[model samples]
Target: MTTWDEHAAQLADTVTHPRSRWRDAIRATPRHLLVPRWWHNDLTGTLLLDGPTDPHRWMRAAYSDTTLVTRLGSLHADLAHPDDRPPWWPSSSSTLPSLIVRMFRHARPETGQNILDVGTGSGYGTALLCHRFGDQHITSVDIDPYLTATARERLADIGHKPLIAATDATGPLPDTYDRIIATVSVPRIPAPWLAALRPGGRLVTTITGTSLIIGADKTPDGGALGRVERDWAGFMGTRHGPDYPPRLMHQFPHARDQDGDDITTGRYPVLDIAEAWEVNTQLTLAVPGIETHFETDGDDRTAYLLHADGSWARAHGHWTDAPTVHQSGPRRLWDVLERIRHKLNIEGSLGLYGYRVHIEPNGRCHISQGGWTAVIE
Candidate 1:
């Protein structure tokens, strides 16, 4: 219907300046065809939204500038029933159009240069790249064979056929690229990617478990140096196989209700890591792989931090109130968070945004802002 096109134009209006290059591409591509079915949840159970059954709602979901979950845990939306209660984790999605355009702007690709599009979920991004750079110069890769195969078929339906391959993006790449834009986050920059980048090439990706977006250019000595973007963006962490590693819910029972090994009062006001971008990035860099959950009820707020290594922290408090923190395991979780909070208080801002990023050939990433620094080894 004409509504999808109107919605694309509406989405394009939100992105400005550098991202304007892909405005025409955004309007021309049909997102409805790419995402025939998707998943949504209201916390209690998941619902499958298919275009054929509910065209009106489907059009709204597909065209809006929002992420439409295509797969949850191991079940794809195409195979799921209306009443199935899948896991909350989003395994795959058609990323928001604005974010895709923003990332493309960050990559700064020219007309003739070869590009690699990692994480071809719905192939919408791939279609945009093909429309701009031509079919021969674009290669889209994903870990799942079914996804890649379906995406390839979808691309062909629009008469745009690019090289779609099913392979692990973190391992050996299929080809060298002038621009590598990944829609998936990685724990560390893979050495294979660094090697595959041509000299003076650029890589746009996010650090896993955080919203830190990096724009780095390849250096002469096989390393790359650049800076983090001022704005925050994140994607699903890279999946090595059919699914990601198991979550930390198994350790919940032990920390559900207890005095914990350590008890202390939080120094600052209750912080919701999800809403605090700068703090989230800083804490993620300081204590990598920490999982956070936050909830609010009237004046009271509750937060939980869990790690895969049996570490957990639960904080409960209200606005302007000192939160009583309960933490247990090998590491003191709240202590680390408090340290980050204190650093932010001293330094006007966390300085995580626009921090200098340096990636060595050995896969070590170094980030610095003012005197504070973090190294991901």
Candidate 2:
């Protein structure tokens, strides 16, 4: 039987190069201990994989560089039954090891600096950081008490005793720090986070509803200015409570498999938001709360867009052909998307990743590059 430490080394070799400083830390941490039980998709529904029940399957999942959904909606996998299937999307997970390393690479952490690890889901990332920069210099926080307690206990077993607290990450932090690395996304830069960061400190986080990775440094004027990182990454948005806010699924009834009020031909090609990272990122920034779904069969492609306030759009067509677009409700959702597509067509790019980001003391985000500018208040 391959030991967990050897499995950790194999996982590290898969995600990190030989010369990477994070290699040793990844090799030492035992991920299976933190995530003893997780949910995996099955033909019928989600299947609970208990480590004690199936050690082989558990070891494979634990050592693999993939996300393990520990909590779905408000249901934690530890408490879920074998026959249960949580309807809601994943609320928390042990993020992929590769992405965790990618985030740390972007952070460029210095030795002996105080670090705040936000969204301590499974505390795997926190444990890795603790090993890199002793437990005294690291503080890991999460919104759920149960999750924080679980992580604290698991970290202790691994000889790590970082300060683990349960609190809303958007609100005031317990202490200041030289670095803030959030594994969760935020709609806007929280003012309290800005206040907690010391001068010359750096922040690494993803913008909510988009895949834009922001890397900014604190300035003397109580503001931060930086550019978007070229590589894109996304995580579940931060929540103030146990679960996220209500989704736009209410509009699904009127729009699902129904002809809309206005029907026309789409001026652009059919786009799968999941596959088109650049366009999806731009559309998300332009239309903040739009929900998307996409599918394809042979040469035929279909896409649907839904938004709160009763706006929806559906587009269907074959390859290289203009899609038949159907839209309804207060806003013409497809038209808004088309306008963005037109802008992209003319400018050759929306420059979303190239935008200069400015974070004000009040958490207002002002994004601009070239002659284009946008503000999120």
Candidate 2 local lDDT, 42-119, one digit each (tens): 657877789978888888899999999999989999888888877748899999999998998888889999999999
Model 1 CA deviation exceeding 4 Å by range: 1-3, 16-19, 43-45, 295-300, 318-320
Candidate 2 lDDT score at position 339: 85
lDDT, candidate 1, 66-109, per-residue tens: 89999888888877887787777898999998899888888999
Off by over 4 Å in 2: 42-44, 295-301, 318-321, 342-349
What residue pairs are clashing in model 1?
none
Q: Estimate each model's TM-score.
A: 0.93, 0.93
Measured by TM-score, how close is model 1 to the native structure? Answer: 0.93
Model 1 residue 330 CA deviation in Å: 2.3
Judge candidate 2 at residue 151 and give its lDDT.
Answer: 95
Per-residue lDDT value at 333 in model 1: 83
| Superposed Cα RMSD, model 2 | 2.1
Residue pairs in steric clash, candidate 2?
none
Which of the numbered candidates is closest to the native, going by highest lDDT?
A: 2
